[model samples]
Target chain A: MYVAVKGGERAIDNAHAFLAEERRGDPAVPDLSVAQIREQMALAVNRVMTEGSLYDPDLAALAIKQARGDLIEAIFLIRAYRTTLPRLGYSTPVDTGKMATTRRISATYKDLPGGQILGPTFDYTHRLIDFALAAEGDAPPAPQASPLGDVPRVTGFLDREGLIEEEPASDATPGDLTREPMELPADRALRLQALTRGDEGFILSLAYSSQRGFGRTHPFVGELRIGEVAVEMDISELGVAIEIGEITVTECETVNQFTGSKTQPPQFTRGYGLVFGQTERKAISMSLVDRALRWKELGEDDTGAPVQDQEFVLMHADNIQATGFLEHIKLPHYVDFQSELELVRRLRAGMTEAAE
Target chain B: MGLLARAPADRLAALYPHISEHAVLRGPETGAVMVRGRQGGTGAPFNLGEMTLTRCSVRLPCGKDGHAYVQGRNKDHARRAAVLDALLQTEAIGEVTARVLAPLAEAESAQRTARASKAAATKVEFFTMVRGED
Candidate 1:
């Protein structure tokens, strides 16, 4: 006869209380405010917002505070909180072509029309940490320059010359991955959506793998731009479009080498990435992976890489799902463990009897 | 609709105090929802993020059911909106519209105009001069 373990309600409550205390650290120290987290720990907040798929900085900060600064936990909180609200309306798709770019650079062209504006970037910065930043010190103001009017996309230049594959304009509504079940062999629109919200590290590894001959497609950084875009909604009652808000987005377009195929001539292919906020690494990785995933549609032979499998990549890309399943091991598995234990004992007894 | 949904709860309550007598058919509970985004205006839908929302349904004394869903986590606003919605379905529509909807609409319009003007103040226009060399 087996007795089930019980009577730990008070202990569980105490454990929770201890966790709260631990989260606070020292009582003597000042408690961190949501605003402080939003302002100072902005990159972490950005990551949470990007992964969480919500652009609200204040709410992201609050989630960070509630989760004790664990970014994944913060994202989880945001995800949980997001599922309850009703979707009021859908905004018009943001036009990245008209984006008021702050940082626009291209490796393919030095004298691009936009004239390389190196708006706040970590590319040139040395990896060495500055000790002076340990103490609060006001930094000098950055130099300002006027941006060129409507900096045309570098991809547009290629498109003009008919050097790249044409992405024909489509007006069909794409399926909502969250609302509907993810079907296999998803369209480009659906795949791009998944990649945008995919786990940054996971996507990065897959993208890196592609570059390392796993699915060798020589990708060039055609254009990477970060800026704010106006979010508009069409009000039927008002008979006009209104700008409800603005959100910062990072958009990347990668040009890849494509050899001539039976159906089409040799031309450069495009891989696209558009993500919430200023996450360049994620955006770049997303584009590379997106390009690799396009091998089937692009008439390239499948190398059987993990990244090439749409179902595998899309299904396991979410960190929230990954973490939830990974962490469920902590839950009680006594019944299963007991069965295993009995099996092992029975086998040992039989072995001893046979030996005797 | 957003403007109506976002109307201040206290103001709505003050406009119609008898809303307390309304029966809650459903919840004035707060919950999370996924927001979806489209590519290039009308392309594929993508998960934008989650947002907090409060919703409620109310049945008026006159047997009309009203439902309301609003952004953010204000339960009272959702409940009050539901009551107003219920009231709008009855003979008291005129009185409610005059007392509630009109003012809210006017206020929201004014607020929008102010915001637009504020944004417009910072708007810049660029022009390229014709150089003699060109």
Candidate 2:
């Protein structure tokens, strides 16, 4: 009941022209370089990389600049660009154990192996606005110490005591969410992939909801580490797994409340979240949500919570799809709207005639 | 190779100065390599994300082929790294190491020390109280 129409080509072109002009802002001001954004606005770059599922800081910076600092839009640009690049190969699974950690902390332990290194975190900050930053003041040098020798994951302690659930090593080739369409009853691999790239705000809300008793989850931050880990690949030509590069990542592991039936002994459960770039908030939130989704595997009751619903979480978690459908409403839908209006008018007219 | 992947694109050029003519065998092409992570620190593997990687292969006039797989979208970095990779396999390896690899390694270590220093500043120290019997 709708008609097709066209002929906004010139208007569309001019709109883009105006968009470019607006993107530049005042002619008097110096233009911001991609390098500046990459370095200074690093957290923003990390968010785009994590959600866009691409680890290129330069492209993420460029996307941010082009999108005029709209992060979701920047993520869209990165996602589009990734499709253009041909897949070279897959890297060996990164070893977090061998990470050159900058910031590592465990809430459960008072002090453990690798110790608690606060690294760069805003947790202790006063949150007061620093006017000195407005004046471009330089920061004083941070004190140096002898280089750290070795850092181990906090989970190892619980593992040694056999207090926490153990996940045996598996060499199974996990599913790729990007290449394959969303299949129902998606495994942990696919869910983690979706969660890693999911909208940060959405995941945060879900995690918050789970904590608020919508779903029963007593979560504790066992450890959260932000650092760089080498990405390696097995090369047939070289006959060895060569280190390609290091990617900055944030990894979070949560120890949940004990759960066991008559057949099984009580053991602390765990949830994990690993993301590209130093994004601890997203990583922690992802871990909480991940644990919430594991209600089935954990043999917990179906709470009917939004976070527990895999269909809802996985389907709408993608910001690209969510934003596309959402923003599309603002576009010209004259024909569709007109048809609806006409039908309403006809119904009203028929009512009038019947009344008469 | 880790140094090649991590080092800045311009730095590689600065170290090498000049390279003998070489033929491009494969790419100085940018592509993606899927990065994988584990369940806990060590468990079932899953796809974490994709990184922008540039891979290149070059053949020197002396028939030595060098390959480089770097971390970003800089084709020039890949090319220079590839050429150096080939040169390192040749008689000029000692010179290349002194100029490029050694300097890069020193810088990498320095940077690591700096980060470790900052992190070390924040390392928590705990004190336990002991009870004295009366």
Candidate 3:
């Protein structure tokens, strides 16, 4: 039972005012612009966009700014704002094969077509604190070289000999979680959607757990690429597909060990993760979780693992819902607690009398 | 239309002839387009996420209608793009392409080349030997 208490309206208003003031910080410092956040703190914006399930960088930057750089709070604001906008229509499925790739690499091979272009990675960088960055100074420009050509997917090589599982193309439309209520025993598409937008930390931990032998799949990174793909929409008025814009995305494909089933022979299976912007961590994590979740599909036993528990993962992955349930205790539970208090006291008195 | 939407509003304004009036057939209102991606990048379509976009539908006085969808909430960009689209359908298509699309495409190509060059520099060198195990 719950009661609506009607006090502290002024207090609430004052608290909000104080919050706004605090958000501004010391008056001496210059204010941070949305553009700066969008450009400088790009990874933050990327995470917000992927988890918030929105594609507009500017909106994500604005949300990040308003939330005082609290990412989950920023994601919450984005989701709240997202629900208000009317959905115009659907875009034609983006073709990532034609992506103007900035970064392309494969762990399965030492070298692949288009070579391993490690565009702006932290892999080789020592984790040393570069104090030069803290004070202020411009870094030198990266050297320019002749552009690479034909960055093909590593999975395609295995596909040539039918060594890897074939995921045949289809024109069928997959489920939309935003518009529809989630149903249990979801297909791969639905599961991918949930994982892609799930909290990064939660997904990361789960991925880490799977690798730690909970529900190991013996995963290998077949390919990881970050690039821009054009967004095309079939406009009815124009009677053609129009390229509205382009957005950067990171895609990770994992080749996992697959034991033979009664219906099929031994072959390498694939786990995929594609997310908006250069969010390789989330993308890679998403791929690992995706493979682990495919236990049933692959004819492997569930092993009673948390990774294999689709319902648990999907239902609790959203930070907004999880936080709402956990944070609601902060609200006044006066009546509920009062009843419990009386019951406890009465029970104690009865026990004392019985002892006498 | 794609090139028009991608072009800057100020650039479009400067290049295209001033259209006195046009019927606002649809909207210069902000909405979202549900972006879909393929399964494993080559299979069944699944909803990726919604992208904020502003769209406009306009018909010129000469009856050449245009529709455009531009990324983000800039109503002016959407409207200008739509106006340019309508103008392109008219006899002035050649002039519009020369003035607007050509210059925009050149600039875009230049930017793409610059980015690709930077990326190309980071490609792995096969000849670089790893340290021998102790």
Candidate 4:
């Protein structure tokens, strides 16, 4: 007689113990500290923070360490941790226009305000890896002088000429996607929120599809800025807004060509992306997808592209949800498989009798 | 307040040794909290990310309760800040203000000035000259 497989708890405990041992790798090497991950692996920390929707580098680094450098798992840890906290108060919005920019550039103009500050970027670097970096050595610090004054946004110049489509100022509050369940036909604000937290690779592919004639919007990089922005909170007790702290952010704006329609004249439409930390690729991709999703509002024909479908893009963009469902298949499905086997056997027996 | 709470505990302890005699009313526990962002400074609220925060509550012998929430896993900083917070509410406000907060505030401002100067050194001035070609 076959007894049901027991010792699931024991097996799980042993497996976890094995995983913990494997995670440490070698006893000969020193363990990586959270601070090391936070400082040295800054980009990875930034990505986890951007996707996890949290800004604390320390926690993000710890998550990265605990997740064994798996970004999606890090994001999952962050998301799980985020739900337990109390909503202290909402912070006043950050102003990218006033950002102390580290990197700023525009592809549309040869010369523009801010003189195209490249800051720290990997764009011009050759793909070849420097093997010398394999052996641990301290990197010599490059001397840099501070840039004076604020660099005016490139979009401001276009707006001054009335060349681009007018984005009227509105004081209306935007919906919080994290607090409320996402519904169809999401507004620009809600869509942007989704894109900022969306998976970088997924958004990149969607943005690429739009550029490759799937949606076909000739996008010009109007402005892309990465830097620090101050976060302030309105203290009702003090009756004044106080600066809580500063956080690094990446903001992108894309200019897309729009032809004349019956209701509107020919003008350039805009797509915007803003994310936590220094994530230019994600920001650019998000902007492209943001513009694509605005097909209906822009009076453009629906191309039925996956990027244009807000529902599809937003729903599938989260890696945590995707990984959970995909990995769930590894779990036992013995009862369901047995039922299907019995049904097939019964059907085969009935078919043989009917044929006789 | 967050800045004061986030200030290094060892530094605070060294600067003000009087705050060590407070009772831990709540905890110097480590946890995580969600951070939020707004659209363009006054727009709708959106979830930004989770940040690791250390929080604690303390009661001074003078019967004042104080609390603190600081960024990172610095439990000592949280406890020290909470103790200071309680003391500040008592008659030692002037002394604590002079001994504790003044130094922290000065250090914070100096740090900010240094950062500003560093950023200002890279400033570029662009000029568009007329070629007289209409």
Candidate 5:
């Protein structure tokens, strides 16, 4: 009675059905709306977009709704969706210098060109829970104001006096990590791409590790800026650039003490972090990790540390990729296991016969 | 979805509309067409540049609680696979299950059986002839 057992298709179907039922626990509970998820769970949306590499809040929100609040699954959805999108055109390097900033601050200098505006931050917020929000109560709307004429950037003032270091611009186009494989000895742009898409918690921990004598490079939050930036693409048909839309971006630049190494002089080194939406904490953490990884580039010794190793950093950075690959182990691997089992059986049999 | 074995490039291009029609398809803008793209053989790990992948997800009817995400090399393939998966739930699971999933399994079994029968039929019994040299 050797009937070849086969029911993966049925199993898959039933499993899916089970998952669907589980996603909607109770009929009485109000179903989550895309708008509600987008507005209320904005940080989750920001994380999805950051990891997904798509700036569509609506899509992210939809993904969130569909995934049943599983952020990584939402990210996976976004990534899959984004891959289908056609590459329209590359925008000219965004001038963060001319950014219409809502929150701008410089820890390096208090008296910079544009006075630091601590517009909005959860940094000072107390950890007390608001029990009133359990009823979904709506608060009165905050007052709005017209745009300021000239909202100068902190970096601009530094560039003027040559106080801050300037990264040289190259005519060569930057490599797209999504399209291409990540190669070793990555340039700044490639590194930044890995960092931006990297898991915030992981990066935060790694940055924290560096602070606690792992690869200690005392880093100060030099300038943390959160604002909306115009996304412009040069349309060949239009014969000029056109603004497609605006996206909120959080950019962090950490300034580390330039203790002169053996080879290079003591110049203020910088770590940069940029992410979609207002993610200052993530951006700051990213910057610290970036600086820690750049130790070798600045002719510093490779201390065999986690943050210093580019391969380790880039490989384990993206939560979507890492988690997906990690979770995939749950999938059927019986065939591969069977091969190993067969080998072990043969070897054990041979050993037994020889011993006998 | 239609069963047409298109060139990989065309299949790759077709993925854009299949996954998301709203997706920007600036194929020319990317110069990606000029770059040689090839996918690894079946069951091989997905590598960068070598292969073009088109993944898709569909919401199966909420029977249980979660959505069934069917990923594949082609968008249409993914959609078809998802549909098949969804159908197998409510439909006669036995026949379709064997037909769809173990399509390769059946083929492999047949191949092994054929090989074994062929080997048996052509069995080379080594018998020494008694008076051959004498």
Candidate 6:
């Protein structure tokens, strides 16, 4: 006389409570404040901002806290929040030529107008865990200096000589990824947008894959610059452009030797990367992937490379989307599975009777 | 919100401000907002029902044809569809894919992963033991 159980509502409620408890952890330990997480775990905040496509650090930290330090989950939270906001007017593209740079490096040319500043980077650091961090020792703050006025872009120098390639400027406004669906054969702007909002880990791995001969495009980091850039918007009502705010951005351009195709002559092709925060690795990876995707536009033969395939490249570019579609199979697919089971059983029975 | 009360074209025109002028009526059903285009849904030979879809076809500045599909359950959905329709007609398909689809896909993916990881974390092993009488 046992009846089928039907306590799904209570079960869900208990599970939510358990999750809340798990998120808070122990009561005795000092709880990590959102400010602390934002300041101390800045890199995590950057990742969420870069991928989430939002520029709010506090919100990113709050999302990180809620998701229990799951960066992607935090990004998801940020995206969900961002989508609910009303559409504001688009901002004019920032002039990188006017960027007050902190770090500027060029692999192509050692001597540039603004000498390379190897500002805060892990490149020179030995890969050893600092024991002092475990003790939570108070580190002395470094001296700050006012930024040198307007550092001319490294690309500007190359553009004068016509030695470097020139990307055609289009008057067409770019699409918004958050509001629409992705189609095939994305242009440079669209590609860059995808790369900017793309998963840092996924982009890093893809860039690595390109280096490992999957879609090898010999790239020299032409210039990698990180600095704060002013964002300006045109107010149509007032008929005047106004400076809204400033945001940290990382810009990278990779120079690659192009063997002239039928349509063009031998020149150094460029791969561009731009991210919302100080994300150098993402910028570099983005540059590499960007170049790989440009093979078709450059009239190079389709080598059946993952990077060369526009549809494949664009579709798999976003880690969140790729992972979501990949993982959705695990959901309670009992209904779908039942249909499949019925089909399989009927097919098997038909085949057996035919054999008999 | 309301179906066409006159000619299918007039009804479609009426729906233009409500549903989407670009949308073609696939069929009719209660609570079914069915439309067909290459922009949304499972880009394949399949059928879907119970969607709040608005579609519109518009002429772009460069004299190019464009189509858009927005999913929702109201006038806002149609409005969004109209905006997308306008943009799609003007912008490059690839640009739309990157700027719009990719981000959405990323969010969808993150959600799916969270669900999967959570499910995986809760997995339990089942076992049975024999009694000594056996």
Which has the greatest TM-score?
A: 2
- State the DockQ, from 0 to 1, for candidate 5: 0.01
What are the per-residue Cα lDDT tens digits for candidate 2 across B30-91? 99999999998788999999999999999999999999999999988999999998999999
Output the better candidate (4/5) by DockQ.
4
Among these predicted structures, which one has the highest DockQ?
A: 2
Instruction: Pull out the clashing pairs in model 3.
Output: none
Compute the DockQ of candidate 2.
0.84
Per-residue lDDT over A234-260 for candidate 6, one digit per residue giving the tens place of the 0 to 100 score:
646447655444556787888887888
DockQ category of candidate 4: acceptable
Chain A TM-scores in order: 0.96, 0.97, 0.97, 0.95, 0.90, 0.91
Runs with alpha carbons beyond 4 Å of true place in candidate 5: A1-6, A143-149, A261-265, A342-356, B1-134
Q: Tens digit of lDDT per residue, candidate 4, span A1-356?
A: 22376668988999999989888999799999998999999999999999988788888899999899999999999888777765555566677778877778888876775677776778788978989899989987544565456878777787788788766655456677777998988887778778888899999999999888898866999988888886665656447765545688998888889886887778887887788899999989988998899999877888888888888998999888898999987777777788889999999999999999
lDDT per residue for candidate 5 within B37-123, as digits (tens), equals 001000111111111223223434544111111111344544443344444555435754555444534654464344333323322
Ranking by DockQ: 2, 3, 4, 1, 6, 5
RMSD of each: 7.2, 1.6, 2.3, 4.1, 26.3, 20.6
Greater TM-score among 1 and 4 belongs to: 4
Tens-digit lDDT string for candidate 3 (A239-284):
8888998889999999988878888889999988989999999999
Query: What are the runs in model 4 whose C-alpha is more than 4 Å off?
Result: A1-6, A352-356, B2-69, B72-75, B78-134
Give me the TM-scores of chain B across the candidates. Answer: 0.84, 0.93, 0.84, 0.86, 0.33, 0.45
Off by over 4 Å in 3: B8-20, B128-134
Candidate 2 residue pairs in clash (backbone atoms < 3 Å): none
What does candidate 3 score in Cα RMSD to the true structure? 2.3
- The regions of model 1 sitting more than 4 angstroms off are A1-6, A236-239, B1-134
Which wins on DockQ, candidate 1 or candidate 3? 3
* Model 1 interface CAPRI class: incorrect
